[model samples]
Target: MRRRKLLAGLAATAAAPLLGSGSVQADEALLGELLVTRLRDAMLGLGTAAAAPSSPEALATDFTRALADFDACRYASLAVRLPRLIRVGHALSTSGGDTEQHTLLAKTYLLATRMLVKMDEQQLGWMAADRAQQLAQSTGDVLAVAESARQLAVLARKAGWHDQALSIALSAADHPDLRGTGRAGAAVRGLLVQSASYTLARRGDRDGMRELTDEAAALAKELGATLLRDHGGGFSPLTVQLHRISAENHADDPRAALDAARAISLKALPSVERRSRALGDIAVTYDRLGRRSDCVRTLLAAERCAPQETHARPATKTLISSLLVSGPTSTELRGLAERSGVLV
Candidate 1:
C-alpha cells in the first residue's frame, strides 16, 4: 500500500508539468522522500523481482537505457526505472555467481547513490554507496571499484566526514589495479582525484585543493577526449573546469568560481546533466557575489538546459528559496520558485 502510494505520487509529480498545469509545482521534497523510501525498501530485499527471469543480454540493454536516461537528465524516467532495475539486478546477482550480473547490480546501486546524493538523502545515499562498493569489489573490476569509491567519497563528504572522504577518494585513485590500465584507468583516476580535491576544498585547504586539481587536469589532458565510460563520465578538460567552479565556490573564491565559469559553455558539455550542473554552480557563485540578476538569469538558463535537474535537485530548490526571500525579487524568479515548488 505504501509503495503504491509513493509510486502514484511520483507518477503525478512527473506528469503534472506535462499535463498543461502551468502553475502547478511538484513537491520535490515529497518526491525525494518517496524515492528514498522506495529505494531503501528495494535495497533491503523487500521488493519482488519480475515474474519472468531476464537474460543477461536483455538486462544489459535495459541498464544501458536507464543509464542513458540518467545521462540525459531525465530524472523522472530514471527515478521510475531505478527501483525495479535494482530489484531485478539483485535477483540476477543472487541467482548465480556471474560476475557480469554483479557488475550490473553494482552499477545500478551506484546510480541510485548518485540520485540519493543529489536529493540530499545522505543516509540512504550511504546505504546505496556501500552496496555499490561491495558489489563492485565482488566483480574485481578496478574501474567499477574506483567509481564506487568516488560515490562513497561524495556521500562521506556530504555527511561532513571530510577526512574519510579524502582518504577514500585518494586511496581509489592510487589503487594498484588502476595503474597502467590505459585511458579508462586514467579517467577513473582523474575522477577520484577530482573528488579528493573537492573534499580538500570543503576542509578549507585551498592550496591542497588547487594542487590536486592540477593533477586531475593533467590526467584529463592525457585522456585527450572526454571519455564517457560506464562510470560517471566526463573526464576531460571541460569537466575539470566544471569541478573548479564548485571548488572555488567552496573555498570562498566566488570570483574564481565565476572565472572558471567563464571558461565553460553549455554547448561544449557532454550531457544535459553536466550543463545544468555548470549553470547551477554559476548561479550559486553569482548569489555569493551578490549578483542577484546574474544569479536568477543563470538559474533560468539551468532550467532551460534541464528542467528536471533545476526542479528536483535540493540545492537548486534551496537557491530558489533563497532568492525568493533574500530581498528584491523579479517575476521570473518568482515563477522559477513556483515551478520548483519552493515554499516562500
Candidate 2:
C-alpha cells in the first residue's frame, strides 16, 4: 500500500501544470521548429518539388489572402502557408512564362521574404529576398526591381549589415522607375529614404536618421496619399513616423523613445503588424526605464493585439524573456509570460 501510494503521488506530481507534459508543449515546440525548418528549406533551395499544380489566378488569390493575414499580423498562419505558396509559385513560374504570371510570382516571393525576415530566420530570409529580386528583374518592371531592393535592404538591416542596406536603398532610388514623378515614384523614393533612415538609426547616427526621415516625409506629402502595400514601396508619412519611433527607441533616450512614439497616433498605423511593433517598442522603452508594471501592461497589450508577432518575432520574444527573467514576479506578469510560452 505504501509503494502504491508513493507511485500515485509521483504520477500526480508529474501531471502538474506549467512545466509539466500535460500541456502538450512538445507538440507545440515541434510544430514551431518544423515551420522554421520548412522555411529554411524553401529559402535555401533544399525543398522537395511536389506535383501540386497551381493556376496563376489561384496563386494570385492565395497571395492576396496571405497578404491580408500578413497585414493582420497573423504570423503563425503565414508561417504555415508561405512555404507551400512559394513552392507552388516557383513551380508555376516555369510553365507559360507570361509577364503577368511572372509578376505575381515575384510578388509571392516578395511577401515570403518580408514575412521570413520578421520571423527572424536571417539566412533563409536573405535567400528569399535574393530570389524575389531575381524574379522582379526577370519581370522587367523597374518598380518591382526597386521594391526588391527595398526587401534586400530589410534583410540586410536584420543581419546587422546596416551599411549594405543603406546603399541598396539609396542606389535603387535613382532607378528609372522613380524618374516619372508619379505616385509610384514618390512612394518608392519615400520608401528608400525611410529605409536609409532605419539603417542610420541602427548605426546610432541620429542626425542622418532625422534628415532621411524628413526626406521620406516630404515625399509622402508630394504623393499626398498612403502607400500601404505589403512591400515597402507603399511607405507613407505614417510609415516614416513609425520608423521614427523605432529609430528613437534604438538611438535616443528611453524617455525620448516614448515621447516620439507619443508624437504619432498609435491607432493610425496602417497594419496590425506595425501597430503591434510600435507597442512592443514602447514596451521595450518602458522596460529600459524600469517601469515594470507599465512594461508588462504594454507587452500584454502587444500580445493581445498580435500574438503571433509576440511569439515569433525575435525582438518581441526577447522582451518577453527579459521580463520573465528580471521583471516583476507577479500573477499578472507571470500569466502574460505563460500565455506567450516565454516563461516555460
- Across 1-344, the per-residue lDDT of candidate 1 in tens digits comes to 99999987865653444223112234643555556666776788664543323687887877887778777777655545677688888777777749888988888988898888888888888888888889888778777788889998998898899999999999888888899688888898899999999999999999999999999899888879888545786689999999999999998899999999999877998887888889999999999999999999999999888887788788999989988888898899988887787875
lDDT of each: 0.81, 0.71
TM-score of each: 0.89, 0.84
Candidate with top TM-score is: 1
What lDDT tens digits, residue by residue, belong to model 2 across residues 1-344?
Answer: 99989877754543221121112233332334445665665555544433233667776776787788878876445554566577776666676658887787777777777766666777777777787788888878677788789888978887899889999999998777567747776688788878888888889998888898888888787776687476662576777777777777677667777777887786888788778878988888898889988988988788788876676566766777787778447787776666656654
Candidate 1, residue 65: how far the Cα is off, in Å: 1.0
Assess the local accuracy of residue 49 in candidate 1 as a C-alpha lDDT between 0 and 100: 40
Lowest-lDDT window of 10 residues in candidate 1? 17-26
